[model samples]
Target: MADLEAKPPLSPSSTLEKQFEDFRHHLEESESLRERIRAVAREIESVTRLIYSCLLLVHQSRPIPEVLEKVKAQISKLKELFHRLAGILRECPGQYYRYHGDWRSETQTVVSLLGFMHWLETGNLLMHTQVEERLGLKTSEFGLDIEDYLIGICFMSNELPRYVVNQVTAGDYDCPRKVLKFLTDLHAAFRMLNLRNDLLRKKFDGMKYDLRRVEEVYYDVKIRGLTANGDSTRDLGIQGQS
Candidate 1:
């Protein structure tokens, strides 16, 4: 009772200083996370570039088997890098879309490359599920974005015209007809999407040109009677003359 000393309450200035310190700490942590993400992104870019280079052999008209064999190693490396990216994203939880821009373009390119490769081998569009599976991504936090998948498919469509042209130039005239049918279906499917995304809309617009170019190529091959059976081309010619 003789020693009635009371503890002083925290001053407003001190409280403010404490809050500022916390703010600073948070900013530092966010910056640190950004730096780490950038580092991982650089590694992902390197792996992606390697994978792209391997895939480019297709444009060289290299045998598909040989191209696939060479691309397999890069694909393994890409999957590892993607897993590492997913792990990093896990640390921040709920912030995936924030950093998604960092990797979105590269991911689109990877998807396009893989989609082209799969189409070459299977004559089918690689589904988004298959892409996630190939990349070893979990559907929960690291699923491939639907926009990225669609954009990638558009990019793959752009490749088909060039590929058909190359194949025709290489005397594989059957390629144009097959590619034309595939692109026609793909274009129609894309038209069904209610796309509001400007970039994707632009890409889909380009797909029409791609379809047209392939159709032109198919017609070129048909008019020349270069189809594998020549029967359809001859029939078309007969109809045209009549």
Candidate 2:
């Protein structure tokens, strides 16, 4: 009996139990955070769809100003959602990438829409910093991924082909030439970057098709002798607004 008593009872190890308890609490907190992030991301995605629907009106030959007016409200909503995302990410202080995948698709979509909108509003490539500013995402903590920005730009490029086609159909003959010029310059600019991402590279390759489509449309317009003779600054481009 003394031997058993001296050996002590077979109680659980307080140290091990405390460590496991800490781990469980950590996992619970992490799950809660992820759920919050996902909620904000879902809202972001919803707003993106709303903005995209408004942008489609442009393809339907709707007036640019009218489409923009509808999009403006959604932009305000996206800013709020992104702000909420940034706030939630601050909970961990230094783990932005840990949860980045949660909103990756939504953010990419947002950037694409914003890039297209910026092009319509200003006729310039939407810079990364500009996107950050537009979304109110400029925090010292963490922010938009560069790959997401590049991918979004590629997505924006995909829209130009369709826009140019519709523009010519709408009797805006010079639209093709201006789009061709813009795409040429944009493609040249992309060539300067040493992009290593497979997805981004694939998307960039697709821009060539966009450029080709625009080129074909421009040549068709040129052959038909229907090109506009204005100073080339009245459509799709906001002078001095970039």
Candidate 3:
């Protein structure tokens, strides 16, 4: 009786084809969305590069206010691109991470550029919230990932050894001391985290080298008895008399 009342199996020719056709359509839509996301990410990366180039003027000891102004001028353009990316991702609700890889590198680079800028302007680490706020990212909708932000910070640290060298050559002898302090504190803060990210862990390791370079610079300055607090005459006079 039970066997007689059982329903028939779905037709392989009709139902299977329909199911596969649905799968095919879904894949096409996802690919289309990914391409759109990639387009926006490319633009964002271009803008990030522009900002990074502008900030490179720092290595030349360019005026902080001027470098910052040039970088800031590009902020609105970045914000608009990010907004467009968010709009595209919104098509797939609750799936931001699904396509995260499509734009992860670009986002990390942008954060590094912005982090470097903020450090130059204020001599402080750019907090994650500040990144979102400055980029005009709606936190509840689309937010900056913590790992990306941390990785960006590591990139920013890579700039410091060169920066310290440049600043010292430019006669800012006291710069190394300040940078050393900051890097030391930053390194300590990183130690507190159990950084499991392979890239982040590697970056954190490189930061040690940055700290060491700054330390050497600071030591050289201190031992030379070079007064870097703008007392140029006294510094020269003491060195000459010695």
Candidate 4:
């Protein structure tokens, strides 16, 4: 008698249709956004595999200066692709809101997605410190500044929790609508990240407390829990450069 509340997952066809419908509605606001989304989707379909491979390498490798170099190279490649994508969008018009609506907004969206992935990448590094230390390496000397890395992590971690907040609290029609579609796409990427390595989700969960702090700072949202510190970071045994 307890079988009345199950929900079904969205079929692939339904997902595409919903995305297109949202695009059409958003296009009514700016044709450029519609065009840019299509362009980026095409690029994503083509380059996602490469990005995944790089991400996997970053996640799975032991800490060494060379590995950090490789990670930096991968990040540079990601940024180059994003910039090229943005150049295509800029050929149309206006500043990409990265936070608001318009044709250029797609760059901001892509940046945020990349940022989240990067943040997780770093968090993984910190979480695995003992492994790196065992190899006689210091993760911090990868040669990145705190502000730059922190901002990227903050931006990336913000995406989902912010999406959650927008769904429940925001009154802005356009912003919420855009965020919903972006959130769906981000989750799809998250699923791909999970599939690439069965252990990622488990490892990710082990660092959830740290990630939550990132999400909080990114969205300027607060939670009622003590922030993880000291042995909290060490107990996880994740290597951190800082």
Best by lDDT: 2
Instruction: State in Å the error of residue 217, model 3.
Output: 1.3
Model 3: per-residue lDDT, tens digit, 25-75? Answer: 999999999999999999998898888888889999999998898788899
For candidate 4, lDDT tens digit of each residue in 136-178?
3233322122233323332444444443344334332232223
Candidate 2: where are CA atoms >4 Å away? 1-21, 228-242
lDDT of 1 by residue, 134-173 (tens): 9999889899999999999998888888888888888788
Model 3: residues >4 Å from true position, as ranges? 1-9, 227-242
TM-score of 2: 0.86
How much does candidate 1 score in TM-score? 0.87
TM-scores of the candidates in the order shown:
0.87, 0.86, 0.88, 0.30
**True lDDT of residue 6, candidate 2:** 90
- Whole-model Cα lDDT of every candidate shown, in order: 0.82, 0.86, 0.85, 0.40
Q: lDDT, candidate 2, residue 103?
A: 94
Note the residue pairs that clash in candidate 3. Answer: none
